[model samples]
Target: MAEEEVKLHGAWGSPFSKRVEFALKLKGIHYHYIEEEVLTKNKSPELLKYNPVHKKIPVLLHKGRPIAESQVILEYIDETWKGYPILPQEPYERATARFWARFIDEKCWPSVWSSFSEGKKEEAIENLKLLEKELEGKKFFGGEKIGFVDIVANFIAYWVPLIEEATGKQLLGEEFPALCRWKDEYVSSAVIKEHLPSRDKLVAHFRARFPSN
Candidate 1:
């Protein structure tokens, strides 16, 4: 491959992987897409070499260098590409954006991911409401546009709902109308919708993974 080439190693059903795609598309960068069979634990040698520690997908190979971790790769994409920006411009704003993204990955998403367990739903809703409150007076965590935090929270907008359906859990509901509205707005956008995994495929993936649900 040429030194200037860009390649993305990812799985189709992964929200982490797709967030990187969202950034690349927004930046109008053309990249080769390499699918890794992550679900079956059949990681490729290339993916292993690129992300040896994680042994996972969503590794971005740009200019002959490997960048792992979706969040890290996102910042790299924004900095390396010229058109669209995933992170904010101002120093304080950029820090705040990173903070919220970290909160989603560390706090909110974890709470919801385990909410199916007994007595965990309340904790999950509490964390979700924290995010809902953050969305106040803004269309997205990125304000009027989609930014780093919004991309980080893509799992909540798409995957979490499917998890609720597959697990028969009530994490998202009428209690948070603002979040519901934001979810629809985010997922319905032409840029995001164009690349989102089909609902049928996601539902089937969820069902197959959690058959007991």
Candidate 2:
């Protein structure tokens, strides 16, 4: 297979960007990583050009063709690389995976953030319960291996704990034992650990972002 020039434009603190990085690494694909400073108005011209619509971080350029949106990028990577399948082969299972991924990205993320910032912890816990049921007996969302839903829910494994610490509240508890167990496994997995930001760094970042008590 001929190697294509691949590049990813993203920021360090973005879970969405990390999902793409994790996908690429899982597929054993090498690519250049370009860090974009969205806060400082330092988004590169290439990033702006590639993702004019969103003008957001996490733009994957494959042979100079840009793929915007982390979920879309994950699908693209799985399709392009035949090895290390990210989505299941069965149609029903594939649809289920995509559905859960969308649920996490759309509904769960907002609820989780609202709980952290607005003090609506109950709402976040409800959302987490749904995931816990989905993960009932599975080692991962993708059964044995980390898959689409797991990648999309990466925020739960890393960022949510920091949010809990910063808010001085425990949003997740013994009620959701399965989800808690999954989080530990997901964060400590060798591939995921390599891509995750250090716990200290993440704690500091959250503290800086949400300093008020």
Candidate 3:
């Protein structure tokens, strides 16, 4: 594949943006990463022009063409790069992978975030259990390899623990031993470790945002 200009507009603290960033790095794609001020609502003009509809971060600019949404960007990266495929080859498996990825984005993510922010402990535990079931008996959602679902569920490997620490809540524990082990392995893996933000930084981000959650 020939190299073309690739850029990503994202913010450090956003799991959505981290999804795109991790996808790019996992695919060995080099890109210019632009940090956007999402917290202050001072989003970059380039971000606005690229993603005018949503005006959100994690926009992938390839050869100057913009692709919005982290999930879509992950697909684009996997499709564009032939090597190190993120999705499964079989149609059924690929579909199932996409289903779980969407599940994490649409269902699990909201539940966890709302639970943390609004102090809905039961809701958080219930949703996390659903994810634990999904991950049980498999090395990853893609089965033994890091793939699309793993990338989509990247927040679980890092942010969840950080949030628990910051909020003094126990969303994951002995009850979900497999999920906990997965987090330990995922974050410790060299490739993921290289891209993941520092745990201290993540903890600070959460503490500042939710001091008494």
Candidate 4:
């Protein structure tokens, strides 16, 4: 493929946006990144046109077409660039990887985020425990090498510790030793370490967003 213009429309604090950004960086793809302010009602006209249904941020505009959903965008980047393959090449392995990725994106993410609210502690802990069990004794969700599922699972790990600190409730502890080690490895990776959001900023943002909780 010849040199093409790629653009990402995203918000700073959004994990969805960060996923795409990490993929792009890992693949050594040079693209323009437009950070959107999603807190307010206003959204960029480009974003509006790209994702008409969801009207959400983290839209990846490749050439002229736009792709929403972080996981979809990550696949697009890997397939298009062929630089750093995020998804496994084998058919069954690719399917397995995608399965876990979707699980993290759909189930684990919602449960983890729900912990921030009042009256959701029990449910959140149960959900987190399930994840811990699934991840027990695993270096990465995809084994040794960091793959698509690992990336998606660890998207919120950076915030989870701080959330625990803020709320004084530790969801990940000795009970999930492997998971804790995995979290450390995931965060320490160059791609994630460089691009992760500021901890102080995230704490302040969440504190303001959920003041009572």
Candidate 5:
């Protein structure tokens, strides 16, 4: 079937899914998007069949072969497709980009979540500061163009602010001037503006999780 040629199982609200979408769009690759009910316990059978281990959103099926994990899928897309490259050409630059993406997923995200939920800001603040330093004087983490690191960091640009608004918890503020500026610029772009989850839907999602919100 045409849908199986290049299909993606993802959720609208997931930044992970958006990462794959951005790479495909930028590369001018055509694909079918399958929206899965990721919030519920009963995940779709397709999702389970594909990424049976994690059973998560953002499972990419290209040429009928399944690829799980957002970071792994991103590298696969970059290597498989030509033009509108997601990663850098040079080895050192490419490695640097991967380093930062890993940092975002492993260190930055956990620290930021801790700050949001536990009222512990030091680690998260430091993580943001590190990313801010890396992004200094650049339009994006991937320099002037939106590349791998920027795709990995869509959460900082879109989701965090909505969650903050929903929970009435102020983690990001004037202190993160560069990050704040980056957030504004990133979200203002037509591509990002188009694909990001609606603010209303996200706020409602967060409020549901944090009942007091």
Candidate 6:
């Protein structure tokens, strides 16, 4: 018998959705994953009813109440489940983790996305440098082991590299060897490595949607 009814409304390609999915899987939670084709206008009424404002995918319905936003859903999963805690137990460490997570949300992710969309080469390189400096000597964003911050930081991994390939430019430079190494470590995690979108599929998807120069 199932303990709680969990359903996720998310699109296949969305990194936000992938984050939520990874957190759920890490907690060993049984969930029904409904792939919402938001771009194709295939959202369900329940999704709209739950997240009225954004109406975005990656809505986690616990029992019946829906939670929007991938980060929030991750915290919810951590709090609701007792197994394999994704967040640290100590308050200070938890605060630090949250700070880095928010940092990625506010600073890193936006910069990367902007670079991807507008072909802002110089600005993208600058942002990537900042990230590299910030992550110097750090094993993961949250330190030794994979945590919430690592999950958020690595969210754009699949897309950013694809963007660079499409544009024929490497935003992650050899100068930032530490950050590049960190990226490899973060993505090579058993869970992340297994669940990430296929490169060929993503390249094809982006080529069709965002044709390069």
Q: Which candidate has the top score in TM-score?
A: 2
Can you write out model 4's per-residue Cα lDDT over 1-213, one digit (the tens) per residue?
Answer: 333579899988787888888888888888888888798868989889999999998899888899998888989888898867799999998998888787777777777777666546666666667667767878877777677877677655677887776666667778777678888988998888999888888888777767775
In model 2, the runs with Cα more than 4 Å from the true position are 1-4
Which run of 10 residues does model 2 get worst, by summed lDDT? 1-10
Model 1 regions more than 4 Å off: 1-4, 117-119
Question: Which 10-residue window of candidate 3 scores lowest in summed lDDT?
Answer: 1-10
- Model 5 misplaced regions, further than 4 Å: 1-3
Name every residue pair that clashes in candidate 5. none
Q: For model 1, where is the 10-residue window of minimal lDDT?
A: 113-122
Candidate 3 residue lDDT tens string, 1-213: 334599889988888998888777778888888999999999888999999999998899899899999889988998998878898999999999899888888888888888789977676678778878988998877787789988888898889989989889877789998788888877777788887877899898899989776
* Candidate 5 lDDT, 41-110, residue by residue in tens: 6689889999989889899998889999999999999999898888999999999999999999999989
Q: Give the lDDT of residue 27 in candidate 2.
A: 92
Clash pairs for candidate 6: none
User: What's the CA error at residue 107 for candidate 2, in Å?
Assistant: 0.4
Candidate achieving the largest lDDT: 2
lDDT of each: 0.87, 0.89, 0.86, 0.80, 0.87, 0.79
Q: In candidate 2, what are the lDDT values of residues 1-213, reduced to their tens digit?
A: 334588999988789999999999899999989999986888888888999999998999898899999999999999998889999999999999999999998889999888877777777788899999999998899898998899999999888888778667787789988888899999888999988877787788787777784
- Cα-based TM-score, every candidate: 0.94, 0.96, 0.95, 0.91, 0.95, 0.90
1 or 3, greater by lDDT = 1
TM-score of candidate 3 against the unseen true structure: 0.95
